[model samples]
Target: MVLLVPRYDEPRLLAAEMELIDQSFGIAMLGCALAGFILALGLSIGGGHPGAFPWAVALAAACALGHFGRRAIAERLSEARAGLYARGMTALLTVIGGLWGLAAWLYMDVHSPATVICILSLIAGMSAAALAVFSPCLPVAVGFFVPAIVPVWAVFIATGDSAYLAMFLGAPLYLAVLMVFARNYARVARHAIALRFANVELIARLREQTARAESAQHEAEEANRAKSVFLASAGHDLRQPLHALGLFVVTLGRSELSDKQRQLLAHIEAAAGAAREMLNTLLDFSKVDAGVITPQPRAFRLQPMLYKLENEFAPQADARGLFYRTRDTTTTVFADPNLVELILRNLIANAIRYTNQGGVLVACRQRRGCAVLEVWDTGVGIPITQRRAIFREFHQLGNPERDQRKGLGLGLAIVEGLARTISTRVLLNSRPGRGSVFRFALPLTSQAAQPADASAGTPGTMPSRPSLHGLRVLVLDDDPEIRTAMTALLQSWQSVCVAVESESEALAALADFTPDLLLADYRLRGERTGQEAMEAIRERLGRVIPTVIITGDTAPDRLRNVHAGGAALLHKPVVAQHLHTAMTALLSESGWRPEIPRAAGMRMHG
Candidate 1:
C-alpha cells in the first residue's frame, strides 16, 4: 500500500521543509509575543500584579529578539547548512516555550480565578501555536509544547483542589493530542516535498533524453555528408584512369591489326564497357540516394519518346538476333521528360540484356485517365517469389555467377528510383519459363498535340572517320595521356590539333592557332576549371568558339556548374563515336564548313 505520508529521510527534502518553517517562524513568533504582552498588561492592571507584568513583558521582548536574531543568522547561512540553523531555531523556540510556561506559573494566584484562567489560557494558546509553527520538524514541536504546557499543569496540580486537579490531568492530555497532530502534519508535509523532488527528477530525465536524441540526429547528418564526399572523391579518381584508358582504346582501334588482334581488342573493349556501365550505375544510385535527381514535369507526346527508344535499341536487338517492336500511340504524358526517359531506358535495356530468343516490345495504352507505358520481353521470366526482389540494388535473375555481360543488376533499381521520383508506380507481371512485362502509368494531359509523324529523328549515324579537313581544334586537358589521345584522334579526322595542359599554355597556343573548336576538361591543374579556361580563352580570342567540357567528376555541384556554363558536357570514359558526334554537331551549328585540304600535322605545346 502507498503511504499518504512519507518519511523525511532525504536531506534535500528536510532542508526544504526547514527553510519553509524558517520563513514563517518570524511572523508566527511576533503574533504570539504580541498576544502574551497584551494578556500580561491586562492581568497586571486588573489583578494588581504589576511586578509580574514587567516579567511578562521582558519574556515577550526576549522571545521577539531571539526570533529576529535567528532570522539574521539564517540569512548568513547557505541552504546546504540549514540543518545547523534548524537546530539553533529549535533551541530558541524551546527556550521561548519555557519562558511562556514560567509566566503562567508565576502569574497564577489562588485568590484570583480570573488571573489563573487567563494565565492557563495563554499557556494553552502558546502550546497550540507551537504545534502549527514547528510541525515541519516533529522533535522541535515536542520540545516546545512539552515545556510550554507542563509548568502550567504543575502549578494547577499543586493547588490540590478538585477543579485544579482535573484541569492538571486534562492539560497533559491536550498537549499529547497536539503533539500527535503535529507529527501527522509533519508526515503529510514531507510527502508533498518528496513528490515535488520526484517531479524535478522526472523533468531532468526528459531534458537529458531530448539532448541525446538531438545529438544522435546531428551525428547521422554528419555521416551522410561524409558518405557523399567520399563517393564524389572516389568517383572522380576512378573515372580519370578509365577516361584515359577509353581514349587509348579508341586510338588503338584506328590502327591496322590481324583477325586475332582485332578479336582481342574486342574483348578488351567489352570488358571496359562492363566496367563503365557499373560505374555509371553506381553514380546514378548515389544521385538518387542524395536526393539530387529532381523531377521537371511537363506535358509531351509519348509516341516520339517510344520511337526514340525503339530506334536506339534497334541495332542492339539486330546484333542479338532478336526482333524489336514499338506500338505508336498518340497518348500524352504529364511528367518529367528526362526522368521518364531514364526509367524507360533502364527497363528497355534490362529487357534486351535478359532476353535470348524472343523479341522485346515497347507499347502504350490508356488506363483510367492515365497512359500505361509498358515493356514486354520474351525472356526467362522471374518467379513469383522473386518478383519484388528484382527492383533491389545488385539483385538479378539467374545471374548468380556474377557475369559482367549479364550486367551489375542496377538497371531495375534505377528504374524504380526514377519512377518513384516522378510519383509513378512501376508494376511487374511475370511467370517462370514465360515472358515478363514492366509497366508504369503516367497522368495523361489533353494540352499536348499529336505530331504529323511519330519518329524520333533517325539516330545519328557516327562516321567511321569524321572529316574535320582544314579545321583547327584547340584541346585543353591536364592529363598528358588524354591530351595525346585527343590530338591523335582529331588529327586522324584531318584537323589541325593544338594540345595544351593548362590555361596559360592554351592561351599561349591561341596566339598562333585560331581554333574552330575548344574541347577542355572540366577539372584542370590547381584551382582553375575548364569552364573558366573556356571563358578566358573565348574573351581573348574575341569570338565564341564551339566548346565541349569533358568531366570525370560525377559530383552534383560540378555537374550543375558544367550545365550552367552553357556548354555541352561529356562525362568521363566517353565513347569515341559520341565525342565525334558532339564535335560534329557543334561545328555544324557554328557554320564551319570543312574544306578539302592537305593533311595537317598535330602540334603539341607546353
Candidate 2:
C-alpha cells in the first residue's frame, strides 16, 4: 500500500505534525540511550569487547545532540519554512536508525543467542514506539523503520543457519504490516486536525451572524422610535390650524344665508368634518400606542352607551341602504364607560363601512358570569390567515389601494388597544362568505345601576344650547389665528370675551376684567404653558376659576401632565358643540349663571 504522506503544502497541518513529534523528543532520547547501554553491556558480557563501552557513550552523545538540536530548530521554525523542518526531522530519525543498525552489526558477530535476542527485541520495541510517536508524517516513520530493520535482516541472511535465514525472510513482511498501520494512523490524525479547523471557522461565522442580527434589531427599534417622534411633532403642528378652522366653521354657521349659499356651506362643513374625522383617528391611535389612555372602570349600565352609538351610526347605515339594529339588555357591566363606548363605536363603524347588503347587529348576553358584548356584520368576512393581521396598525382587507373613504384602517387596532387597557381583548370569529362577529367580555356587577337617561348627551351631540349669553370668558393662546378664531367664536355665542396671545397679555387683561372662566392652550410662546397661565390667573384671582386646558399635543408625558393639573382637558380640533358643552359644564360646576341679558352686557376684546 502507498504511504499516507500528509501534504506539506498545508503549512498549518505540517506545523501541527511538527509539534506532535517535538513533544516526544525526551521519550525518544531515553529509549535510544537505554537500548544502546543495554546492548553494550550484553556485548561486554558475551564477547568481552573492549570498544563496547565507548560505543555506547558515542550513541548517547549523538542522542543528546539530536534532542537539543531539534529543540533549537523548532524555536526558529516559521510558517514558510515548516516543510524544511519536517524534512530535517525525518533525516535526523533516519540517522538515529542507522546508529541502532550499527549496534546490531557489532553485536551479532559474538554469536551469543542471548545477546542477539536482546538486541533484536529492543530494536522491535523501538520501531513500534516510533510508529506511535511519528505516525503523523508517513515519510518519517518509513525512514526510521527501514534502516533499523534492514541491517538486522542482512546479518541474519549472511549467516548460513536455517533459523537465521527464516527470520531474515519474515522481516520484510513484518516491516510492511507496520508501514500499513502507520499509513492508516497518519490519515486519521490529518482528518482530526482538519475537522478541528473547520469547527473553529464555523464558530467564528456563527458569532458574526449573531452580532449582525443584534445590530438589525437595534436599528429596527430606533426606526420605530423615530416614527413615533415624527407623528407627535406633525400631529401638533397640523392640528393647530385644524382647530382654528373648526372654530371658524362654528362661528360661520351662526350667520344668515340664502338656500344656495346654505347648501354650499353644508358642503364645506362636510369636507371639513371628514378631515376632522381622519385627524381624530390618528390622535386616537397615537394615544393608545403611547399608553396614555388609562381606563376608569365603574359600574355603569351598558345600554346608554350602546344607545348613543346607535343614534350616531344609524343614519350613516341608513344612508348606505343597510339596516342598523341593536338588542337591548339590562346588563350592567363594570368597565370604563368611555373606553367601552370607544371600542363599540369603532366596531359598529367598521361593520357599517364594510357591509353592503345584510344588516349589522349589536347584542349582549351574559356568559360565565360576564357580559359578552358582540357586533355582528355581513361584511366580506376575514380569512383565517388574516385574522390576526387585521389587528395590526394600518392593516386592512379589500382596500389595497388604500381608499381613504374606507377609513384609515386603525378602527380595529384602536378597538383592540382600548380593550387591553380594560384588562381584556377583542376576539373575532369569521367565515369567508357569511359574516364576522367581534366581541369582548366585561365583568358583571351585582350592584344596581342607575337607569339610562335618554336625554344624556355625549360629546358632538348638540345639547339644549347652554346659554353662554353675558358670560365673562378669558382666552389665552399663542397662535394669532387661534386667538382671532376664539374671539369670533365666543362672541358669536353672545359671551363677553377677551382673547390674548401670551401670559403677560392675559395677566394684563386680568387687571381690566374679572374673568368668570379661563380657556387656554396647553403650549404657549414662552416658558409658561396654558395650564401654568391658568394657574397664574387663578393665583392672581385668589380662587380657582372654572378652567379648560386645550391641547394639540398627543405625547404621553404631555397628556399626563395636562391630566394631572386638575383642569378639563380637551384635545385639538374640538367640535364646536363639544367645546360649548365643556365650557357650560365647567361654568355650571363653579355655580356661575347669566344674570344679565346678552344685548345689555355683551363685550368683545381682541
Candidate 3:
C-alpha cells in the first residue's frame, strides 16, 4: 500500500518539479548571460583580445534569444506537453554551458594569467548559479554542470604546473558537492508540492461535508414541518366527532336515565375524557414545537392565582380521598398569568396523579426577590436515575400498562415547555419511595396585590345558567354531526339555534333569522372560513353580535390568525361546561338583541 501510494503521487511530484524549473529558467538564463557578457567585454578590452570579443558578443546574443524563446514556448506549453518542453530547456541550458566552457578555452590563450583567473572565477560562479536554478530537476542540473566544468578542468590538467593540476582535482569535488545540494533541494521542493496538493484536497473534502450536513439539516426541518401539518389536519378531523360527542354527553347528563344506563354513560364519559386528554397533549406539543404559544406578561397577585388552582384541583383530590392544601401569599408576581397558571396546573396535576396515599400541597414563599411556587406531594417519589427522563414526552415511570387514570406522560413535558416560554425554571427534588417536590420561581413585583374578586368563582365552576329562553343564536360549522349536536345542545338550553354548514347557508339563515350571538368553527369548507362566515352573517344582519371561534388546529400560523380575529377562542374537544361559560360571558358582555325581521318560515330545529 505504501509503495503504491508513492507511485500514484510520483506524476504530481514530477510536474511540480518541472513547474519550478520552468518558472526560474528564463530569469536565471538572462541574468547569467548578462553578467557573463559584461565580464567578457571587460576582459577582452583590458586584455586587448579582439578575436574573442566577437565570440563573447555572439554567446550573449544567443543566450538572450534562448531566454525569449523559452518564455514564449512556456506560455504556449500545456500540461500534456510540459515534459517535452522541459527536456528541450535542459538541452538549451547544456548548450549554453558548453558555450561558456568553449569561451574559456578560446579566451585564456589571448589573455594574461590574471585575466585567465578572472575568467575561470566567472565561469565557476555561473556554474553554481546554474546548479541552484536547475535543482528542481537533478538530471537537468547534472546536464549543465558536467559539460561546463569538465572541459575547463581538462584544459587546466593539460598544463605541467602543480597549481593547474590542483585546480583539476578540486573541479570534480566541487561538481560532486553541487550534485548533492541539487538532489536535496529537489526532494524538499517535491515534498512541499505534495503537501500543498494534500491541503487542497482536504479543504475540498471539508466543504463537501459541510454542504452535505446543511442539506441534511434542511431536509429534517422540512419533514418536521410536514409532520406538524399532518397532525393539525388529523387533529381537526378527529375533534369534529369528539366535540359533538362531548356536547351530546353533557345533554344526556341533563336527561333522566336508569342506574345501569347512567353507569354506562359515566364509563363513556370517562373514556371520552381520556381520549380528549391525549389529543390535547398531542396538540399542545405541536403548538410548542410550532412556537405558537406567545407569552402575555403582566403583574398579577399570586394569591388569587394559587387560590384558583387550589379550587380547580381540590375536587379531583377529594374524589381520590386525598387532601389538597394551599398556603396563600400576598406577594405579587410579574409574568404571563396564563402560562404561569398552566405550568402550575400541570405540576399539581402530575403530583396528584402520581401520589397513591398522601395529599398534595401548593405553597408560595418570598425568596431572593422572587416568589417561589412549590407543589409538594407525599407520593411514590421518582428515582434519581429517572428524574431527568420524567420530563420527556410520553415517558412514564410506573405506568407500563399505560393506565388512563395515571395520565399521559406529557404533563411534565408541557410544563417544561411552558416554563421555558415564560422564561422560568422548574426544579425537582425527590427520592424513590419518599416523595417529590416540584418548584418554580417567579419574579416578585413592587405592584400592590390586586384584591381577589368575591364575584369571581373558583376555576372550572359553571356560571348560573342565564335565561336563554327566546334568545336567538347562530352557529356555523362544516361538520353536520357537530352542527346537529350543537343545535340540540343549544335548544336543550332553551336557546333558538340556527346552525348552518357554509357561508352561503349562514347568509340564507341570517336573512330569515337575526341571531344575538355567532358561534363558529375556525376551519370550514369550500374557499371560506368560519371567521369570514361570521363576518358575512353580521354584515347581512347589520349588527355586531358577540362571536366565539372554536378550532382544533394546533398549527402556529393558523392559531395566530384565529387569535388575531379578536374573538373568544376555544380548542376542539372543548369541555361542555367551559363552552357554556364562554357563551354566557360573551352573551352577557355584548347584550345584543336580534335586529332583523324574523321570517315567517323561520322555525327552530330540535
Candidate 4:
C-alpha cells in the first residue's frame, strides 16, 4: 500500500473558500487513512497472518485513494456550483471510508467497537457542514435525517438479543444528538448567508455612490469652463459698442458743455472703465483657476512701477481724505509684468478703498539684493477673527456702519495669484478698526540704480517716459471708427499708421508697406484670431514684429492664448496714451525714439 501524504500547497489552494469546506474534507480523508493504516499493522504481528494483512491493506488503500479522489472532485465541482454532484461524491466516498473504519473495529472486536467508526464519520460530516456555513436549508435537512436514521434502523435489524435491544434503545439518543448538531450547523450557515448578502448589497451601494461623485466632479469642471466662455462672449460683444462709446465720450469731453455735463460724462466713462476692470479681473481669475496663467519672468525696474502706483493713487486718496505714500530704493526685478501689475493694482486699490480719514503709505527698501515693498494704512482694519477668512471669494465683513457694496471681495485672492506669478507675496499686518499692513519682497537687479533717488528717501516717483519718434505703426481692427481713431492717434506722434480690417486687406497693405510695428486685435474675421494673423504677418515681414494683442474679450482661454503668443497684451476701451505707451515700450529696441511726450498731449482725471 502506498503511504500518501498531502502537500502544504493543497491547503493553500483549497483555502479560497470562505467557509473552508475543502479543509474539512481533507482532514476527514487523513483520519480515514490513519485508521486504515492502524488496521493493517494490527492484523499481522509478524508474517503469520498474511491473508488478514492483505485484507486490511486493501481497505487501507481504498480509504486513502477514495479520500484523495473525492476531495479533488469537490474542489473542481465547487467552482461550477455543482452542489448535487459534490454532495453525491462526498457521501459515496465517506461511506467507503466509514466501511474501512468499521472493518478495523470489527477485526479488533473492541466493545461497542463500531461506535468509534460511526463517531468518526459523524464528526467528518458535521465538520464539513459547519465549515460550509452557507449551504441551502434543504441540503442541511437531507444530510442530517439520512445519517441519523442509519444506526437506528441497524439496531432494529438485530432486535431479538438483549444487547441488540440496548443498542436500539440508545439509537434514538444518537439520532436526537445529531438533530441538535444539525440544527446548530444550519443556524450558522443561515447566518453566514445573511452576512454574505449584506456584504454584496453594501458593495453595490458603494459603487453607485462613487459613480455619482465622479459625475458631479465632471459637472463642476464643465460649469467652470462655461463661466469662462460666457465672460469671453459677453466681453467681446460689448467691446464694439464700448469702443465707439469711448471715442464719443472723449469728443464730448472736449465740447463747450456745462461743468455738470462734463462731470456726468466723466462718471459714465469711469463707470465703463470700472466695469471693464471687473471683467478683466474675472478673466484673470478664471485663467488662474484653469491653470493657464503662468509667470513669464523678465527683468524690469520694480521701483519705477511701484513709484508710478504711488503717484497714480495719491490724488485719489487725497480726494477721499486719505493719504497715499510708498518707500523703496531698489527698482530692478526679474518677473512677469502682467502678474506684477495685477498684484500692485489690487493691493494699492484696496489700501485706497479701505482707508477713510487716514493715510495709505506704500514703501519699498533694499533687503540684501531683493526689494521689500510694503503698503501701510491707518484705515478701518480687518478684524482679528476674520483675517484668514477675508481671502475667501465674495466674503465681506460689517463695520460699525458698513458700506453695503464695497470691493468685489477678490482683492486679496487676486493678490495671492499675482504674488505666485512674480514669486513675490503680500504679507498682512492689521488690527480691527486700527489699521492693516500688506508687504511683499522682490528680487533685486544686477545693474546698479542711478544715484539721485538712493538717499532722497522717497517712494513716489514720476514714470520715466521713453522716446518713440519715427516708430512705424500698423493697426488691424475690424471697426472702421476704431481703425480711424488709431490712425489719427498714431500719426500725431510721428508714427506711420497703416490700419486695416481683415487678413486680405492687411496682406494688400503689406505689399507696399514695410512697417516696424504690427498691432493687431485678438479677434479677426474668417475664424482667425490675432495670434494666427500676427503669425502670418510675421512670416511675411521676415521678423518677429513687436506685436501687441489689443482685445476686449475676457474669456480665460482666449486671454491664455493671447499671453502664450509672446506679445504685450492690452484690454480695450483703449486710451491713446496707453496704446502709445505700450507701443513705444515694445518698439523702443528699433531706435525709433519719439521726442514728444504723448501723456502731455492727453488729459485724464482719477
Candidate 5:
C-alpha cells in the first residue's frame, strides 16, 4: 500500500503566514514598549530627565494604539485593496527608515553606543507604529529592517574610535544579534502582510454576503406583496366568470332543455367548480404563507355551512351508491369561518373520493363542551403505520401515481394548515381496507348557521347581481375580447367601463382617467405592461389609485413581478361573484364571506 502525503494548501499557507504576521507585530510592539520603558527608566535614574520617561510611556501608548488601529484599517479594505496599499507602504517605510538612520549617523557623534542603539531602536519602533497609523502595510517592513539597522549602526559607531582588533571582535557579536532581530522582524512582517490580505478578503466576502441577504429579503417581501395583490385580483377575475356561469347554471336549470343538455351543463358546472376551487386554494395558500390568515374570534353560525355541505355532497354520495350522513345539527361557533369551511370541504371530498361501497357519515358532537365535526367514511382506510406520516405534504396512501381523478395531496395538508391557524386539531382512526373516521374539534359561537339569519356567519352563497347603476370603472387590456367582456360586465353592473387597447390609450384617457378604479391586463400590446399603465394613470390622476392586473398565467415568477410592479393580480376565467366581491371590497364595501373551519388533518389525505 502506498501512503499519500497531503501538502499545505494555499489557504493554509496564507493563514499561517497571516498568523505569523499579527503575532510578530504584537510581540514586537509589546517587546519594544518594555525595552523603551527599561531604557528610559535607566536614563532617568542615571541623571536623564524624568520628563523623557513620560515620552517613552507615550511612545508605548502610541505603539499600542497603532497596533489596534492597524488591525481595524486592514479589516476596512477589501483584500485586493489592502494588498495594494500594503505593498506600497512596506517599501516606503523601509526605504525612508534606512535613509533617516543614515542621516542621523552622519550628524551625531554619540559615544554611548547602547544608548544610541536603544534610542535608534525606539525611533524605528515609533516610526513603525506611526507609518501604519495611515497605512497598515508599512509596519511589516519596519519590523524586519529596524532591529537589524539600529544595532549595527550603534556597534560601528562605538568601535569607530577604538582599535581594529576590537572592531573585528565586536563585529561578529553585533552580526549575531542583528541576525536574530532580523529573522524575528522578517517573520513578523511577512505574517502581518498576509494577515492584512486575509482580513481584507474576509471583509469583502462578508460585505458580499450581506448584499445578497438584503436582496433576497427584498425579493421575499415583494413576493408577499404581489401575492396580496394576486389574491384580490384573482378573486375578482375568477368570480366574474363564475358569476356568469352561476347565472347560466341557474338559467339552464330552469330551461326546458334535453337530458343531454342538462348533463352537459353539469359537466360545465363541474369544470366551473374545479376552477373556483383553484382560485380559493391560491388565495388560501398565499394568505397562510404570508402570515395574513389571522384567526378572529367571533360568534357565527356553523350549522348552515354544514347543512349546505350535506346537500352539496348528497348527489356525489348518491352517485357513488354510498350513504353520506351527518349526526349533529348544532350551529354557533366562535372561530374563523374561512378556515372552517376549508376543513369541511376537504373531509367531504376525501370521504367521497375513496368510498367504494358504503356511505360517508358527517356528524358534529359536543366534546368537552367544544363543537367537533366528524367525517366517517366506508372507504379505503389508512393503515396505522401510515397515519402519522400522512399529514405531510405530497403524502398519499396506496396511490401509485398522482392521477387526475385524485387531487393533489394538499387536501389534508391544507386542512391541517388551516386548522392550526384556528387552534383546531384533526384526529384520524382507521384500519387498512376497513374504513376511516376523520374528526376535528373547534370552538362554538352565538350565530346559527342558517340562511334565514342575516348576520350569523360570512355569507356562504355568492353575491347577488345588484345594480352597479352609477359606478364608473376603467378596463384596460390589449386583447379585444377581454376588453369587450369586461366592459359588458361593468356596464351590466350599472358602471361606465372604458375599454382601452394599450398604455397609450389609457394615457390618452388620463385627462379623464379618474374613473373610480383601474383594471389592466399584465401583458399589453407594446413593450408596456399593466403596471406601467397603472402608474401613468395614477400620476395623471394625481393620487395613488386602486389597480388590478388581470392575467391568464398564474406562474409564481410572473406573480412575483406583479408584486414588484405594485399592483393587484387576478388570474383569468373570471367569475362574477368573486369579481363583484373583490371589486366591492376594494371600493370599501367588501361583502365576501371568509372561509369556514373544518378538520385540521383534512389536507393530509391528498
Candidate 6:
C-alpha cells in the first residue's frame, strides 16, 4: 500500500521492488545481529545489566530464523506472494529494531554517562544501516527506523531534565527529515527500474525487426537470381531466331533487287539492328555484374578512337539537326582501348539522343598525368538529385514512358560499370536545362602507342574487305534455321562452308573435308557445351584450329565460362561485318591469305 511499492495491477514493478527488498534483507539482519550483540555486551559489562545478554541472544536467534528460507521464498514469488513477503520482511526488521530499543531501555539506568552514550550510539548506527538497506521499500525502512530510536527519545523525555526535553523535541524533526530522504530515494529507484524495462522492450523489438529485414533481403536475392536465369534462357532462345533473321536479311541484301525492295530491306535491317543493340546492352550489363569484363590497359592514341566515334554518330546527329564535334588531340592514354571506346560511344550517343537544338562535343586533354576524356552536350541536363541515381542499372530521367528511342536506360549504367572495370570513376556535372558534361580520367603512359591495325581502322569504318574465297570454314549449331542461314551467308562470301546440327555430324564431315576455321555455338544439345566440342575437335586433329564461340546467353556465370575458354566470343545476332572482321583476323593469324579478285572495291555493310 505504500507509495514506494508499486500497486498489484503492475505486477512486474511490484515484483521488482519485492526482489530488491529481498536482496537487502540479509544486510538488515546482519546489522541487527551485530548491533544486538554489541549493545547487550556493553550494557552487561559496563552498566551491570544482568538480563541484557540473555535477551540479546534470544532475539538474535529469532532474527537468524527469520532470515533463513529467504532464497526459497523468492524463487516462488508471485504478485499475491510479493505483498506477503514484503510485510513479513518488514515485520522481521521491526522486531530487530525493537531489540535495539530494548537495549536502550536496559542500559538507561547506568550511572556512567559514557556507557549510556555508547548504547545510544550503537542503536543509532543500527537504525541508519537499516534505513540504507531498506530505503528502496519505504515501509520496511520506516518500520525499522521508528522502533530503533524512538524508544531512546522516549527515555530522554521521561527524565524531565531541560537538556533531555530539548533533545527529545528536535528528535521528531530529525526522524521526519530521514523519512523524506527515504521517500525520494525510493521514487528514484522505481523510475530506474521502469527505464530498465523500457530499454529491454526496445531491444527485443529491434532484434525482431532486424530478423524480418534479413528475411526480406534473402527473398529479394532469390527473386533476382531467378530473373537472371529467366533472361539467360530466353535470350539464348530468342537470339537463335534473330541471329538467323539478320543473316538471311544480309543474304537478301547481297542479291540483285529493285530500289523499292532494297528500301524495304533497309527498314528490316534497321529494326533488327535496334533489337540487336538492345540485347547487347543487356549482355554488357550482365558481364559487368558478373565480373567477367577484365580491362587490358595499354597505350593507344585517343585521336583515332575519337575519329571512329564521330564517324559512328555523325549521321544520327545530322538527322537530329544537331551539330556534333570532336576536338582532336595526340593524347595517347593507357587504358583498354575497346572499353574506353565503348564508354565514349555511349556518352556521345546519349548526348545526341537528348539534344534537339544544340550540339555535342567530344574532347580529350592531359591532366594530372591522366587523360581526362569528356563528353559535353547542350541537351536536357540532369537534375542534381538524379545524378547518382542515373548510374544505377535501368534508372532513367525524363523518359518514364519507356520509349525505345530513348534507349533501354542502360547506357549510363553501362558507362559507369565499364569505368569501374578500368579502376576509374565517371564524373558528371549538369544543370536542369542547359547541358551536361560526363568525364572520366584514365592514367596516361609515356610508352609509345601500339601500332594501329592496318585492317582495323576506326571502329565504325571498314578499311578493306579481305577475300574469303577458297577459305574452308566449318560451323556447328543445333538450330536448323541458324545452320541454314549461316551456310547461305558464308557461301555468299565465296567461302566453302560445312554447317552441321551436332558435334557428331561435324566430326563426320571431317572424313572427306579439311577445315580452316571453326565456328561453334556456345550452348548445344543436352549437357554438352561448345567449349567441349571445340576441345574434342582440337584433340582429334592434334592441332589448334582457330575457333570462335558465338553465344546468346547473357548470364554472368555463362559469360565467365565463355571467357575462361580463351576463345574469341561474339554475341548472337552478329552483324555481318563484325563476323567477317573476327573471322578474317583469326585466319590471318593462322597464315591463311585469301586471294582477292581483281574487281571493284566492295564494302560489306552491316
Q: Which candidate ranks first by TM-score, i.e. highest?
A: 6
* Cα lDDT listed for each candidate: 0.80, 0.82, 0.77, 0.62, 0.61, 0.79
Per-residue lDDT, model 2, residue 541, is: 90
The candidate that wins on lDDT is 2
- In candidate 4 the C-alpha lDDT for residue 102 amounts to 44
Instruction: Score candidate 4 by TM-score against the native.
Output: 0.60
lDDT of 5 by residue, 77-119 (tens): 3433445434443444444344335433442225655555555
Ranking by lDDT: 2, 1, 6, 3, 4, 5
Model 3 lDDT, full chain set:
0.77
TM-score of 2: 0.79
Candidate 2: stretches off by over 4 Å: 3-202, 314-328, 352-359, 383-385, 398-400, 432-435, 451-455, 458-460, 465-470, 535-546, 588-594, 598-606
Candidate achieving higher TM-score, 2 or 3: 2
Clashes of each: 0, 0, 0, 12, 52, 0
Ranking by TM-score: 6, 2, 3, 1, 4, 5
- Residue pairs with backbone overlap in model 2: none
Question: TM-score of every model?
Answer: 0.71, 0.79, 0.75, 0.60, 0.51, 0.83
What tens-digit string does per-residue lDDT give for candidate 6 at 193-308? 79988999999999998999998899989977986796698888788888999989989988999999999998998888888888888888888778888888777778877887
